[model samples]
Target: MRLAVLKERRPAETRVAATPETVKKYKALGLAVAVEAGAGLKAGVTDAAFAEAGAEVAPDAKAALDGADIVLKVRAPLAAGEGEVDELAMLPRGALLLGQLGTEHAGAFAERGVDAGSMELLPRITRAQSMDILSSQANLAGYRAVVEAAAAFDRGFPMLMTAAGTVPAANVFVMGAGVAGLQAIATARRLGGRVSATDVRPAAKEEIKSLGAAFIGHEDEESRAAQTAGGYAKPMSAAFLAKQAEVVADAIKKFDIVVCTALVQGRKAPTLVSQPMVESMKPGSVIVDLAADAGGNCAMTKPGEMVTTPNGVRVLGYTNWPGRIPAASSALYARNLLTFLTTFWDKEAGAPKLPPEDEIVRGVMLTRGGQVVHPSLQQQAKAA
Candidate 1:
């Protein structure tokens, strides 16, 4: 079987799906790996590195994808009129496509007879931990958010005991306690900032405390059931959101740095930081909105850009935090793709064999056999 890796054409996307290390692993499994030239350049991997690792450095996407059985990507391929190259048109029929492709192109993939596996939809099962792309990418994003906040903030993070004067530690507040939010808390704490976090999920309280950060949230019956069976956050009711907002508004005024990572599965991110809240913050305060791509948890956020509030609060809404640290993100992401492929590989066939009855396969597979097979996507299509 042959595996193809193409350059990510999505704006602000610096991550590459396959790395030299993963290319070596695919070659060991008797699979031919073809990577487009310069595909890994943004992630610090050169064509020479891929070639040395036993991968064919194809001249372009067309060459890389030629007769490929499987295709790996950081994002979904661009459809006709979406980019300079119609990548979807170039895909070979019956190719197995895998990436963080959103549900937007499920019907197109089905029409083209391609099997599209959206890795972000992977089930949160113990056996699939290594293959979880969302967790791997979010972990890096969480760490990067704190780093960005520190750089944007005027004051230092740590409490400095100087001969001149004593500098108090910055108060960092993380809105959410999921994989990303928890990492933000830990990173902020490691940088000598006093961290606190909030979440709609009741269980996140223990997680926040474990990381030496204060937990702030209004927990009730609704909040207790805020987490889904798959470990994703559920959208809170309007009543619960109101109460949570009240608490957050009071707490955020004193926060020197705020990192917003709250997001509900398949829903717009709930606004945790209001415009009034931004006005309440002191001058030089920095807010990093990690959910910018999902409409942001801060009302002041402008996705893909940074804006300073009238009161001098800086709202950083730069999208694609994982892409900001492409080298590390690509390394982790490549391993995730490699792990998923190996788990479903058919040793005798020397190719992947996704069983129809397999939970992991069913969870990630969006389209197959000329149809959108995933129940969620089917419902989404019906609603649309």
Candidate 2:
């Protein structure tokens, strides 16, 4: 089987689809891997690195994607990057393409005579953990969110006593407390910031406290059982939101750095930080909204923009925080995709899996056989 990696098409998307190390893995699995020239350049992986990994290099996107059994990319195909991708108009015909599909581009590949897989459709299961792209990317995003927040803030993360006087540690408040939120807590604490975290899921309290960050809670019965079977936080009732907001509003005043990472699995992120709430924050404080790609946790945020509210607090809506660190991001993402291809392998025959449902396939199967198969995405599309 042949696999191809093309230059990422999304605007400002610097991440590559595969790393040299993973390309070697593909070779070991009896699959040939090809990359477009300079595909890994932005991620700091030189052409020589991929060449050294025993993979062929194509001079352009068309040559790379042509007749390949599988095509890998960071984002779905867009018309702007269509110069080399043939038959993209037939993407939905269920042939072979895989990527992260946003709300507007979900069924794209099927329309272009290609079968497409969206990593966002990965099912929550013990076996699929290695292939969970969201967790891997979110971990990096959570780590980067802290660095960005610190940069945007007026004060430093850690407290200090200069020769002049003592400077108190900055208070960092993290909302959501999911994988990304927990990581934010740990990273902030490591930087010596005073951190506190909150979530509707009562189960996250210990996870927060375990990292030495305070857990802000209303402690109601509903809050106690906020987790769904898949371990994601179920959206709260409007009544619950009202009460939670009051508690969170009071908690916000004391924090200098606010990082919001809450996201519903397949829906727009819930609005947690309101405009009035942002207005009450202290001047020179900063907010990093990781959920900006969906909607945003902070009301004052606009994706990809940096703006200061009337109160002088900075609200950052960074839609693609992980893209900023394309090197590590692409490496981890490539590993995730590689693992997905390993399940149907016939070790003796040395072939990549074809009949997907091979555990990893079950995890990320979106539309299969010309139908939208993932229940979550189906629900979302139906509602829309």
Candidate with the greatest TM-score versus the true structure = 1
TM-score of 2: 0.92
Candidate 2 residue 326 Cα shift, in angstroms, is 0.9
Mind giving the per-residue lDDT tens digits that candidate 1 earns over 1-384? 889999999899999999889999999999999999999999999999999999999999999999999999999999998888889998999999999999888989999999999999999999999999999999999999999999999999999999999999999999999999999999999999999999888789999999999988888999889988888888878999899999989999999999999998888988889999999999999999999999999999999999999899999999999999999999999999999999999999898999979999999999998889998988877999
Segments in model 2 whose C-alpha atoms lie over 4 Å from true places: 80-95, 102-106, 348-350, 354-360, 369-371, 375-384
Candidate number of the best lDDT: 1
Give one digit per residue, the lDDT tens place, for model 2 in 1-384. Answer: 778888876677888879999999889887888888999999999889999998889897777766687788888766635644543552334346767764355465434546567886777889878988899999999999999999999887898989999889999999988888988999999999999999888778888999999888677888878888889988888999999899999989888999999998878999999998898889999999999998999988999998999889999997788898899999999988888767556787665445654555655666566666555678877899
Local lDDT at 57 for model 2: 93
lDDT of each model, Cα atoms only? 0.94, 0.82
Range of the 10 consecutive residues with the lowest summed lDDT in candidate 2: 86-95
- Which residue pairs overlap in candidate 1's backbone? none
lDDT comparing candidate 2 with the true structure: 0.82
